[model samples]
Structure formats: structure tokens, C-alpha cells
Target chain A: MKKIIYLLILCLTTSIFYSCSKDEPDTANSIFDTSAPELNSFDQWLRDNYVIPYNIQVKYKLEDIETDYAYNVIPADLEKSKRMAFLLKYLWIEAYKEVAGDGIHFVRANAPRVMHYLGSAEYDDRGKRLGVAEGGMKITITEVNDLIPSQIIYQEFFNTIHHEFGHILCQTIDIPIDFRTITPADYAPSTWFNRSDEEAAELGFVSPYASSLPEEDFVEVLARYITYTPAEWQAKLTQAGTTGSELITIKLGRVKTYMKNAWKVDLDQLKAVVQRRAYEIQFIDLDNLGF
Target chain B: MKKNSILTIILSLALAISCTPNIDPIFEKSASERMTESVENVKKLLTAQTNGWLVEYYPEKTQKYGGFNLLFKFDGENVVVRSELEPLRTDSSIYALKGDMSTSLNFTTYNISLHRFSDPSLNIGGGIGLAYEGDYEFVIVSALETEFILRGKKTKNTIRMTPFPTTIDWEEFCQQILDSKPEYRPLYLHVNGNDSLWVSNDETSLTMSYKKDNVEVNKKIAYMFTPQGLKLYEDFEYAGKTYSEFILQSNNNLISAGSTFVPRVPPATWLPRAAFAGTYTLIHYTNIGGTGTPYTKTVTLTEYDNKFLLSGLMPSLNLDVVLDYHFGKGILLARQQGLRYIGGNSLNLTSVTNEFGLSPGAFYIGQQVSWDGVSDPIELTWTDYGQYGSPIIGFVLWFTNSAGLSVGQYTTGPVDQRLWTHIKMTKQ
Candidate 1:
């Protein structure tokens, strides 16, 4: 009886050991450590720090994880994955404060989201062929790879959240007709092509990249207005050349006026906040995680 | 001993159980907790990979392209691109060869304009609209009304009234207006070699040395702004095509907004209406020399939003009148009104100086000056020897702002010489 009992105990131990052993691959270990915990400590951190502040939460099934290039990227390791989540959450909080201001943070509890392990795949180049979003369910990121990078993870988060929220704004209201008149007939993609910095400045764009496309142009203005100092933009405009400077100045003026006249938000204050946040992040000891 | 063994077993079992809780193979989180319902959001992502901004797809399942660089800002309502500079690059294949490549970009001029159309032939494209901020060089090619056949759709593009790209001779015209001095004021005319007012090629004649001649002219002169608000010399042109010259002059005015008055005498001097009003006038002659019946007509002026539209035409006789007028902001008029008879059936307002002979056509005088206020003119004295055969001409002048709206007049030396002379008049 004693021998039989010993055999049974050994069998159980062996089985348990085998099961636990499968979880310890060195390759996978390098992928994620802190992010692999049951509740994903990084996500918990986000919930505790970011989601509540912005009044938003994300939920998703593990298998339906979506990734996009702008706000997500392929991760290099578990540590990197954790860093990315932190960055995204941080950016979310920053964008929220910059755009929505105080007392405007709250989201329904049941929004859907697809939690992704930071080191999974490139949001645009790999993994699932869809985008990441929160509808009304809790999400889990089981895998970790390249689908989320730190820079992409942050910038894209800021952009996507803002853009999606912008859609919400539009769905609920309409913009003025005059805003559409500023784009002239000759605005071309080539306008951005091969233009020198001096020339681009004359044209009233922050950079050639801002001049690359109209959507970018608009978003850059929005980002600059909601997050940066108006003086910074104005200075940039003043430094721009003849062809595009006037247009940019006019556009910026219109944006400020629109924010005031339409949304009734104190955009200048928002601009101050943006500048402050940018300064804070720029000076933060991010350990070389520069965007 | 039994109790102690049992306690040890229980403790070990508890540890084992606690340590072996199955950690499901995947770390999963529910999707609903990550959304924010309290605040409006604008997801303005600058494309990281540069495939262009993702617009919506109709099917909701498939990815589609829309040519609009959506600026997801609080434009009081939704996120949208306000300018063509923010145009979304759509699928280029839908339009033409450039369309496909264009769709890959985030912003392009074509995406904002012609790319909106699915058809190639129907892209009339947006022209220089109200927001136009830069200089444009437009060369009038041709005018026609036609229906453009779009891809299974047709569009019509038409241009009704437009001006061909022609340079306005501003300098010479201004100088001539400056040369038309008011009844008693001395005037000086500055003729630049590069002056657009006159077609003269020699720069030497524009210098102070060209002013040595002393001469007189047939009519007194002054300066004013035009009825259409341009600075010009109000004078008549009678020598060139008889009635043809009059028709050409009228056609030119109508084409260029009916704002220019070409001088008849020197032929080089042109004046805007206001300058003509403040500066020069034609001495009306009722058959002073011969038996060609005297022509007369009563002219009436009506105001059209600060502009005077001359009405009533006498069909039979070519009549001339000496006139004076007042002009305020937005007002325009000329100083002199007169006529010269063309030999046959037409009479034109011209500057033909013949003391006893009947002029072929009736000539009219107009002066154009400044409406945006005038700049102090430099006091300059010079003589032109060329005017002696013609007559001694004197000038006085004033500039209206830096855009160089100058008002002045010119005259022949003492009216003793039969020279086609002018003087420059300065703004008072």
C-alpha cells in the first residue's frame, strides 16, 4: 500500500512539473515577464493610472487582438512590451488632459477592447488583420511580439484616441462651413515634395511632414493647438515662406477661432497645457525612449 | 505523533493546492473596460507607416479609401479636413494613372480636386476661388462652352466674362494723368523708360534733360481717379482709326472694366477717370473754323454706387462740353467732355490740335486720380525741347500711397505754340 501511494505521488508531481516546465522557455521569457502575469501587471497599472483618469477602459478577447501602426508596434521583449503599455497609457492621460480638459473624463464600463501583449507583431504588418479598439469587454494580451513598439505605441495612441473621439464629436455636431474654404485648388502633394525647410516655413507648415497630406495637416494643427504652445506654432508660421505661411497663419487663426466660436473651449489655455505636457515629457528621464 | 503528522500533511496539501491553481494558457482581459463614454474623443493619428489616413469603408468589413485628410478636431462637430492641403489620398485606380499613386499619399492637390470624380474627362477642377492668397499668372487660352463627358456622367464647364492676360501700362498712364494740370496749377510729368503707360522705347526722353522744350497745347489739364477707381489721364483719341479708334477704345474699356481714358494728342498719355476729373478738360469748339454744322448734346450723369454712368447720346451732331465734377471715396469721373467729327458718319472724342480745320472726330477728355488718398508729390521743374515744335509742356504731380497712384497734369508752353503738351499736377 505504501509503495502504491509513493508511485501515485510521484506521478502527480511529475505531471505538475511537466506542465509548469512548458511555461519557462528562454525565448518566450525574453518576450515578457511582468506582462505575462495573470492580470497583466502593466494593464493593471494602466487601469489604476490611465483609464480612470481619462474616464476610459478597454476590453477584448485574447484571440481578437488588433494592432495598428500609428499607436501600436511590434515589441522586442517583455520589458519593452511593458514599457510600451506604460507609454501608451501615459500618452492617453496626456491627450485626455490636453484635449478634454478637467471634469470631462468618463467612459462606460463595458467598452470592448482587444488586449495585446506588447511584443507580438507590427500593428500594420503582422498578427490579426483588424484594428484595436474598446467596445465594452475586458481584453487580454496573451502573446508578446512586434505588433507594438514604444514610439508607435504612444504617438498612435494619442492620434487614434483623439481621432476616434473626434468622430464622436462630429457625429454629435457639425462644423462651420467657412472652415472648408481655406484649401485652395493648387494644394498638391508635390507641394510637400522636395520643399526646403525654409520654403516649407514660408508656406506656414511646422514641417514638411505636416505638409505631406491634408489630414496630417489638419491633425498636426489640432495636435499643436491642443497640446503645444500657440506661440510655437506662430513662430513656426512666421518662419515659413511666402507661399504657405499666410495660409498656415490663416488656418491656425481659424482653428483657434473655431475652437472658441464653435466648441467654446478656451483653446489658448489648452495650448498652454499642451506646451507644459510636451515640456514635461521632453525633460522626463524616459531612458532613451524618445519619440 | 498522529496529530502532528496530520497537521504537517494538511499544511503541505494547502501549499501545493495554492501553488497549483491553473493559470489559463492565455492572459486575457475583457474588451469592454477600456472605453471612455464620458468625454468626446478625436482619434487624430498621424499615419506612422504613411499609407495615408484611413477613411471609412461602406461595407464596414472591407477597407476602402476616401480622398480626404480628416483632421479629427473639434470643428464644432466632427473630424474633417478643411483644406485641399489636408486631402485624403484615396485609391488612385479609380481616377487615372496618377490616381493610384496619389491614393498612397496622405495629401495631394489632385486628391482634393479632380480625384473626387470617378470619371477622367469631367474633371474641370477647382479654379482660383475666394481663398486665393498667392500671385497667379493666368494666360487666357480660349473660351468655349462645352459639355464634358464624365465616366457615364456628364458635366458642363463654362467661362462667360473674363480678361485675357494683358499687362496694364500703369506708369505712362499715371504720368500722363499727372501732366493734365487743373485750370491754373503748374504740373510736372515723370516719364520712366520702363513706364507701362506709353509704348515709347527711348529711355533718354524720360530724363530731366528731355524737359528743355517750352511749348503749349490745345487743352488745359489736371488729375483724378477713374470712375472705376483707377488712376489715369482722362483724354480723347481721334487720330488713329477715326470711328475705329473710338470703337477700339470703348472695347478696351469695356474689357478692362471701362476704367481707362486714352489721351488723343500726344497719344502716349492715358489717364484714369478721377485724375481726368481733377486735372484736364477739352475746349469745346462749335464749328469755330468751317461750315460743318455745330454738334451739341446735353450730357447727364447718374450715380451708380459712387460711380457716374454717362447716359443719353445725341445721334445727329457731335457735341462737346467743358465739365467739372466732385469725387469722394468710391467715386469716379473725368474733367473734360468734347467731340471731334469724323469725315463721314461717325464722330469721336479725340485730341487733334488744328486751330481752323474741322477735326475728323469728336474727342473726349477724362482724368483719373486717387481715391485711397494722395501722397505728397516732389516739387520738380524740368524742360523738354521736343515740346517746342509740339509746344512747351509743364507738369505737377502727387502720389497716392506707395502703389504709386499719382495725380498731375501737363500743358503746352503758354498755349502760344501748337504743341501737343502736358504738365504734371500734384495733389493739393
Candidate 2:
């Protein structure tokens, strides 16, 4: 009887342990919600233009995960954002489309995946950050609260967009060594802010901030040339007296050669196209998305 | 017989465990599924409100800044927000309810009235890292039809939104708050019956500070004014009890659950700061033998922001002295403020830059005789009469080479009691 009890108990316990369901996963995909967002007029416009054509996402609504928490920033104004979206497509996206080798395809391959907007500028002890690019994947534009159409070029917005975009291009193809060698001795990464614009011009760099690094210098020279008029370029040369001017001309020649050889981009043609589009934008209604 | 019974018991217990294996989940749906449903339901409830919702919003993670009453009316993807700060202004913006770990309410577009608190550019504390530290995105912790409990995504402060009544007027409600903001009061928190906490409620920082164990406990109790009373950021704990709302009593004093915010001095009248701009009669005595000389001065007082220039005191010097209205003392404390330029809102009014304080401490205090209600001041008595007792000369001023008040340091003038100690200004 003792043996019978022991065997029965052991068998029953074993059955209890082994009893389980052999079920497969109900769904192959993640259980997380991955639903499509409802598109309004502006969203749909962004989709047709930036999203579908260039595979880009213009995030106007401020998202904490998307922005840098290092600086305090607010959302861009809806009305201003609406105006800016149209202008960006016209002045920036379309400007590239008109110039690049494969046009929109070229933009699709190289352009930032996301373009974020902010109402106010992020100011630090040094100064304000107008635009910042992240790993050639995203670009954040600030101070969109005061976006005036005609004054876009005069202010940092257009120049900053071009500057950030130039960084993306340089990242794609490394900046030529000759360009870096022209102002290697003049580069002051830490104390570049202490140097004035006129002083920077006299030291073979386009702007004071351009003397920070070779990468920054490369982008600044490319962006300034693309945005500035021939007269504006000449004025920079004028300020860069004799030796400084000679260094700047050498650097500029290398930048032009790098763009032509590396990317097949004509700097002067891009400038003319941008300036002409900017001039014609005076009559175009920025608010009209043309959806 | 005992062996057989043990065998049966063991077998029965094992069989029971085998038959009843745990597989059923506690909830009917997954947490993500429930969160999605909850977010959808919240969105529906937000848009379904007839009047809208009243949000008691406190800025910053620590709740160290000010609190604001934000009225939110959600309709589809758009939300129109009104605030107590800007009573008349209304701003509309787009919002989206998306579920991540929890459902978040994001104000996607710029609503100036709402985003001003969150704007880092409007730095109240210090650094680019610190603004009001308000949140544009809020996590809906628990959503309901009547009320929604929220926490800021960045600020991480508990924010509550209750359904606003359709009958109540928003503008009027905001106006009532303006009338009831207790500015610069010597407040006390009555703890039980025997003990009380000496508190300082400052309007500038929206902070209440008290001393405990020789260390100052600065509590930034961000509060908003309602028609009923002042609503604190969260439940304020004192004497082992928590109180969120302070109701205004018949005595016009605010009372919380176990404590009362009893002011040492009566609150200033609800009259606007700009209302104290008019002519007045200056009565003063220059010498001991001098009678309270009444000088009829009919000059329209021009105001630059809150400070006003008061002249006619020491008329021989031809002074344009600046006077600050000390509402707590019911007196205008003489401030050594100077004006630099007057070109399109460029006129500066600072007490530190005493380029215009012709003489140091040459100003006088004009205390209101009565300040109990919301009305224009009727009479102002000279309170600095015997402040600085008998000096030979109250002030001797220096001018620049070009014959204007020069930039330099200035100490408040000795309001010499012996000279002009008896001045009474009655409003005309």
C-alpha cells in the first residue's frame, strides 16, 4: 500500500508539470498600434510634395522626442508654418530639384529625412542657434515666429537652411583637402566667436563662425557663395585685403572644383536659380499649399 | 488504512493542480490595446464637451513657477485656448492624441497664449535650459468624461482638467481672478489652533516661502484664481493635512481645509495701478515754525509702466522724483528711478540707473488714508514725515558737464524729519 501511494502521487505530480498548451503566436507583426494618421490639408500637401517626392517629413508640430532637450524651444506658429512650408518647397526643395544631377531623385537620396520647425531661437551664453543638422538625417530651423518673405535672405533662415543643406552634401562627399589647407593656421575652434566678421573676412574665412573648423568652413564657403550675389562675394574679397583675399580665392576655387568633380554641381548656376526664384516669390501666396 | 488515505490525498492534490493551470490574463485586453482604446475614448470625450474644460496648469517639473487657468475647447483636431493671464485673447492651435507608453496630448501648433509659458526664450529662471519649463505635451494619466488627470511629458507635474460650466462666462471669471490676486501680502498659514506658519506670498515669482528649522522652505505653489477662490498647483501639505483649494470667505480672506491664509495687513484695493494718475494737493512744512503748507498742483501724471513721477516736493530744486506705490503699506515709497530717453517706447524706468534721481533720497512717501475697496484713491497723507530726523541739507545734487543728471550711484535720500516732515496730499 505504501508503494502504491508513492507511485500514484509521483505520476500525478508529473502529469501536472507536463500539462501545457503548445500554441503559436497569433500575429507575426508587432501588437503595437501602427495605424495611419488622418491627414488634413497641410499634411496632405506635405505628403504629395515633400513626402512622396523626396521621402521627407516636415514636422511642424513640436515633438519632444524629435527635438533637442539641451535647448528650450517652442512650436512654430500654424499660420507661419503654413507659409514656411510652401516657401521651403519653393526656395529650398525645388531649388535643389532644379539644380541637382538627378533632380528630385538626387534630393530623395541625399536630403534630410526630417525638417523640424520652432517658433523661438535657442539662445545660449555664446549666442542663438538658428539652424542645426543632425547626422545628415534631420534639420531643425528656429525663429520661425518672425518669418517675413522678403527679409528671409537678410535674416538667418534661408542662409541657415542652405548652410545646413551644404553640411549634408559635404557629409555625402568629403570636403577637398586643398580647401582645409588654405586656412589651417587661421582656424580657431574655441575662440572663433571672439573674432569679428570683418576680422574673419580679413583672415581668409567667409564669416567669423566659418573659422571654427574646416568642415564648418567648407559648408560656410559653399552656402555663402550660393546665397550671396556676385557683388556680395566681391565685397567679401574686398574686405579680405591682398594675402587674405588670395587665400580666400584659393579656397573658393577648391570648393568650386570639389563641387564640380565630386557632385557635378555648378555653384554659379545654383545661385542664379535661387536668386531668381527668391525674386519671383514676392507675388506667390505663401499660405496657398496648392492642394 | 492510513497509508491508503495519504496516497488518495496526494493523488487528489496533484490532480487538482494539473486540472487548473493559470492562463487567463487579469485584463480582457493587452495594455497597449487598452491604451489605444483609452486614447481614442479621451479624444472623443475631449471633443464632446459642451462648454469645454478648465485646466489648472502649473509650469515646470518642480512646480516652481506660476500657475495659470487655461480654458481648453477641443473640436476635432483643433483646440482654442484662453488664459487668465490674457483674459480677452484666444488662440487656436492643432492638437493630436497619440499613444506611446501612455497617451500624450500634444499641442502641435503654436498658440501664443498657451506656448508663452513653455517658451524657453522667455526665460524666467536662468539659462537656455530653464524657461518657465512649461509643457506643450501632456500625458493623459487617467482620462474620464468629467475630468482628465494629466502629467507633463517634460515637466512631470500633475495637471487636472475639469469640465467647465456652460453658464459661467470665461472673461468674467478671469476678471474676478484679477480682482482677487493677493499681491505682496504678509500671509500666514494657520496650522491647527495654537500654531501658525509665517508665509511670504510673492506675486513676481508666484512663490510662497516659510522658515522651518532655520532653513527657508521656498514653496513655489503655482496657483490660479477662480470665481470661487484661489486654486493651488497641488495639495499643499501643512500640519499633517493637504489642501488644494482655498475658498474666499465672507471676510474676503482665503481659507484652506485646515489652514487659513490670514494676511497680517489688509490686501490693497483692487484699483488698477494706472488709476492713481491725477492731480493732488501737496501739504508740507519746511521748518518747525512752518505750517503744513498746501500747494495746489494740477498736473496730469504721466505713467511709464507702473512708476509715476511726482514733482512739487522741494519745488526750489525743480525735481521730477519717481515714487513706487507700496500697496502693502498703503504708501508710495520714493524710488530713485531715472528716465534716460523718450523715443518710441524707449524711455527707461529703473531704480538702479539713478541718472534722473536729481538728488539721492529726495523723494517722499504718500500713504493712502484708506485702501479697502476698488476705487480711486481719495486722500494720501505724507508718511515719511519724520523718517530721517533733522539734517542740515537733505541733498546736494551733481550734474554732468552738459547740464543733465549724470550717471552714477545714488543712495536713498534721508527724508529729513526736521525740514519737511509734515506733508499731506489730498486727491483733487
Model 2, B1-428: lDDT tens per residue?
78767766776776666655667889987777787788888989999986889998877776655577899999988999998877799889999888875889999889977887777664233323355678888998888888999998878888899998888878988988766664435455545453345445543233445557777677666666667777777666766667677777756567777566766664554333555677776555434343455334443444532356665554443445555544434445543222222211112122211122223333231222333454344655433223333322112222221112343322235332113434455567
- What is every candidate's C-alpha DockQ against the true complex, given to 2 decimals? 0.01, 0.32
Q: Per-residue lDDT of A18-70 in model 1, one digit per residue for the tens?
A: 65534443453232223442444545766765466444443321111133323
Over B305-367, each residue of candidate 1 has an lDDT whose tens digit, in order, gives 123433322223323222222221222323222222121111222222224222222112233
* lDDT over C-alpha atoms for residue B410 of model 2: 21
Residues A80-122, candidate 2: write the lDDT tens digits.
9888888888888888789877787878888999999988887
Docking class of 2: acceptable
Candidate 1, superposed: residue stretches over 4 Å from native: A1-37, A50-73, A76-95, A98-102, A106-175, A189-216, A226-235, A261-264, A281-291, B1-428
